[model samples]
Target chain A: MADINAIAKQFTDFYYQTFDTNRAGLQNLYRESSMLTWEGAPIQSAAAITEKLTSLPFEKVQHKVTTLDAQPSNPAVASILVIVTGLLVVDDSPSPLQFSQAFQLIPEGSSYYVLNDIFRLNYG
Target chain B: MADINAIAKQFTDFYYQTFDTNRAGLQNLYRESSMLTWEGAPIQSAAAITEKLTSLPFEKVQHKVTTLDAQPSNPAVASILVIVTGLLVVDDSPSPLQFSQAFQLIPEGSSYYVLNDIFRLNYG
Candidate 1:
């Protein structure tokens, strides 16, 4: 049986820690066997994902999680709503974006890894 | 027992009809006693809702329901994902907004009405 609260926390923490200048902490959160799909892009391996993240131009990216709704179904599956308040420090410009984040999570051992994520921004 | 497909259709049609200048068709889709919540606004009557819609600057509005996933549990509750591709003609400007639309549906007799909706837009 998977502890849903712990899984959800690890899932949320993955995004929050991505803000760090050192990408190793964020990369460590995902299992080497994990899959992460963003938008409609091709499924990437955890190592590939880490490489992509570290290549990004932004100096720092902070995600303040606003909501965490977890729905877990034993060993099969789990889903969570992770609404984040985004602040990106890029080129000395601070851009703030608010969005409701949804992550489809799957568990491996006691920890869970993200399968797919949808970040829907709210703007006029 | 309510047909899940039928309920989903009616809910989607309501938003599409609102795009038409004739407000009555859209109004007809909702039960007088039905509750519709958008954003985090207070509950308002169907009549009040109609007034609010008609008062908007948009001369026309259309909702393209891209996806609908329904979960029904007997007479107690149901939920549907209604993703709308929105196009609003406001002040002679055509504004396009793309987002995933979610409706929390509750059944009343043979028909299901929306309890609340969350629309999350995607922007860079």
Candidate 2:
């Protein structure tokens, strides 16, 4: 059996690192069928997702993950649900914003890609 | 205009209070159509949900919410998506576990009910 926990942690670490350093590089992590509910709006397609990422209000951001949990879907499907809680600092903000993000990752080839993702900040 | 932020905060506060003091009171917050993906298993119906809640591994638990965010669904639907990050202390454990929970709440009468909920701990 694969070490799903370690894989989840590594994926989260790599995902956020790429998110901060190379936003465009995140392209490889999604497919055309991927769906994202960002804050409140639903966005589809890899291209549109990438567009939304590039248009984020913050110019610089850092994610400090405190908790990462993974659960594998039943019926032996090669999919996992990952939940994350972390603090995010955007553009040298004095106070870090708290965030909770969830991702449904599906296996493809040698790696996994996000099938569905939902993200929201803790406060308005 | 209703202050969605305040409403979200109040909802969260009320939720954890009920969860800690009176788990049975949570029955008012769910209906026959409610669905929950807890940890990794899929559970449906109010009766089953309550049964599962009563059978939790820990006897006592406390939730400390750090972040709560809400987004009303589009098309003027009386539905909102709520994301929460918090800590959970179970059974006198010295260390607390990190938790992330998401709920799709739909308005029915004077209050809202959970339509879909997902919860996961951030570790194995």
Candidate 3:
């Protein structure tokens, strides 16, 4: 049995760290087959995912994570479902946007990589 | 084939309307076997779920939905996965909290009811 909560917290911390500082480093988080549903649009592959991230309208952003939850897939699959909610400020916006993200992570060696990720902003 | 997008939008609108006005009416949204993961804790059964909802610390809440996305379970299962993100203001709070919620909706007759629901605030 894995300490899923600990892994989830660590991964989330590392994920947002990279997201806030080095968006380029996020390339290692996904693989060729990784899938991303970003704001209702689907993007796949590491190259495409990186492209999408780099193309976001906001040049600088900060993420404040509030909730982190994880659940292991039944039947003992290596993947875990992680849900995150947070506030995002883009380009020094006065009001931070609320965001929710979910990811399916597969363990590889001592670390885990995202298999499927979906992110959406809370308001229209 | 269902007009999934329309149904999703309509369901989201109705959901928030009831949430802000008549919290008691939320009971009809779930069934006996409905499951809820509220901020990381699991609550099962309609009575339990309702109890949890009514016990929320915030006396008055207003939800401003920013995103609503849905996908049907493959193999023609009657369930659809709905993901939502938004801002939630409780009482007269100055800074509204960010919230993310996901629901598994099962179609029953002409309507759909939540079978599994998970909600979490964005900040600790």
Candidate 4:
């Protein structure tokens, strides 16, 4: 079995990369059953999540991860729980907002797709 | 079936209350298989988590939750994935540190115990 930490690292890299470069393309990372919570607002399903993310007020955003943690949730389904703390600069703004995000990734064939995702801005 | 959001709210209330009043008593919220990652450091088992939490530098701490989100992870095991963003004041400090925590709670009889817990401070 692949190490959960390694897989989480890879997923975070791919996730933020796609999120920064192309927000709409993030839909591929989710399934029909996927759920996304953005700043306490719930958005369900892949297409809706993609739409919500793409419709963000800022046009450009970059995330710099400060910490990433993961643990195996269920060996039966090979699901991994990953949490990330990061700084995000939106629209080339000098002020970066601190944020945290959690993702539950479950196996889909040889790879994984996000099942549960929750995000929050940590500071005002 | 109970709502995951309600359960998550209850858990957060109990957790922060126990944490602020009696840090040692928070041990009951975990299981032998529990994993805790505190600010990127990994601690396994309930005992270790309680110890780590209790041994923090501050004598008094309080958590004010800003947002809480939860989603049903596995119906078979009745596991819920919960994420919280909050501000923590340590030792009555004027500055409140922003933080985020994630929990994977699985049913144990009528209640739930944390199986995976991860926490991180949002900023330096």
Candidate 5:
């Protein structure tokens, strides 16, 4: 009874906006109880997520989604693959970082959020 | 164009047969260049795969597939979620091991081979 495609689009749009200035619009995309786990930071809460985002001086950020696979008729869930490229504004020099992330989406009612995201700093 | 469904079944059948006292019928399923990587042994060749199976004594092995979601009409590839439940025939006692594996299927004509299988020994 849910629109998974619409939910997936909204979830991706939030990530796209996060690059504008640190994680400017990231918080709005997740539920208050959202959980984030990664290498350096195994698990984090929504507040921690926001804190980590603005910790870096990012001049500009861009992301490219490689794959978006959704199960048929499963409006509440989807799997997404993203390649994030960002520039760190530090020491008056810009250094870029590339990341690949696999996201698990969960939709509640008309709104959708990310449940789990496994990411790695890709070098290859 | 190959049938992805058939290929996946064959791959699973080979794994099921490998638990019969030894790898009785595993060689026929894999290509000569199959690469196997796990925690204990990072990478292993076909010979190594065969050796690992027979190294342990087993009266029987059984597997249950939980999810089998495949790309439509893409017979050459599919992503499978398998729960392999097996008994280890050590000390003449049957100890069950449950494994969750994500398999990457590669089909060469009528025969299908596994390109990658990432598995973890699940506890819980």
Candidate 6:
């Protein structure tokens, strides 16, 4: 029996850490078929998604995760579905903004890669 | 190739309609292995999810979808990952609350069933 909870925990920890520190490194976590939707704008493919993510205006940011939920969405494919809600502060901003994200992770060899990712800032 | 966009559009419309009108009826769209995380609380299985949903405080509510994004997460399994952001007015309240939900739908026979669902109201 695969421990999905443990995998999800590890993945999220690495994900946010990489996102906050070395965003360009995050590209390895996706594949050519991967898709990302950030703030209602869709970006396809790993390279494009990485480019868009690394192009965010702020030079530095920090993510504080509030909640993490995971489910084995497709056991046959060893796919884990994860949802996250958190607060993020960009640069020296006085306040943090709330955001939510969902990820579909599929196994690739020993590790996993994001097949689908969607992110949204809580407010308009 | 499956028309994921069309499928997602139909599913979201049906889901919001059922949620607003007959929450209990949403059970047909789920299976025994389904999992739901509602506002950070985890609920396992379909029956429990429907129960918790029907037990929500508000009697009447309306959902206005703002954005809908879907990706073919697992092509082999025909799994579609959907993310939705919307506003909901509860019990004739003048103010509408923002919400976000993610669903992983897998085909079972002719239709689909929700394997994983996570929902949160965008507020404190």
Best by lDDT: 4
Where model 1 places Cα greater than 4 Å from the true spot, the runs are A1-10, A31-40, A73-92, A119-123, B1-124
lDDT of 2 by residue, A1-124 (tens): 2487788888999999999998988878988878777876778778899999988989999999976666553224566667777889999998888777977687888889987678877652
How close is every model to the real structure, measured as TM-score?
0.46, 0.59, 0.66, 0.95, 0.40, 0.89
Model 2 interface DockQ:
0.15
Off by over 4 Å in 5: A1-7, A71-96, B1-124
| DockQ (0 to 1) for model 3 | 0.26
Error of 4 at A49 (Å): 1.1
Pick by lDDT: 4 or 6, better one: 4
Candidate 4 TM-score, true structure as reference? 0.95
Clashes per candidate, residues 3 or more apart or on different chains: 1, 1, 7, 0, 0, 0
Q: In terms of lDDT, which candidate is stronger, 1 or 4?
A: 4
Ranking by DockQ: 4, 6, 3, 2, 1, 5
Encode model 5's per-residue lDDT on A17-110: one tens digit a residue.
Answer: 5656447467665555455544324444567666666664555555554333222212123332221222223344444443434344544575
Judging by DockQ against the true structure, name the best candidate: 4
List native contact recovery per candidate, as a fraction of 1.
0.00, 0.17, 0.30, 0.93, 0.00, 0.77
State the TM-score for model 5.
0.40
Interface RMSD of 3: 3.7
DockQ of 4: 0.79
Displacement of residue A78 (Cα, Å) in model 5 is 8.1
Output the worst ten-in-a-row residue range by lDDT, candidate 6 chain B: B71-80
**TM-scores (chain A) of the candidates:** 0.63, 0.95, 0.94, 0.96, 0.63, 0.95
Candidate 1 chain B: 10-residue stretch with minimal lDDT: B68-77
lDDT value, residue B33 of candidate 4: 85
List each candidate's DockQ score: 0.07, 0.15, 0.26, 0.79, 0.04, 0.65
Candidate 6 per-residue lDDT, tens place, B57-106, comes to 98999998888878877767787889888889999898899888899898
Candidate 1 per-residue lDDT, tens place, B1-124, comes to 1365466667667665654657654554444443433332333456766665566555655555544433331122344333233333334456665444544455557665554344444344
Candidate 5 local Cα displacement, residue B89, angstroms: 34
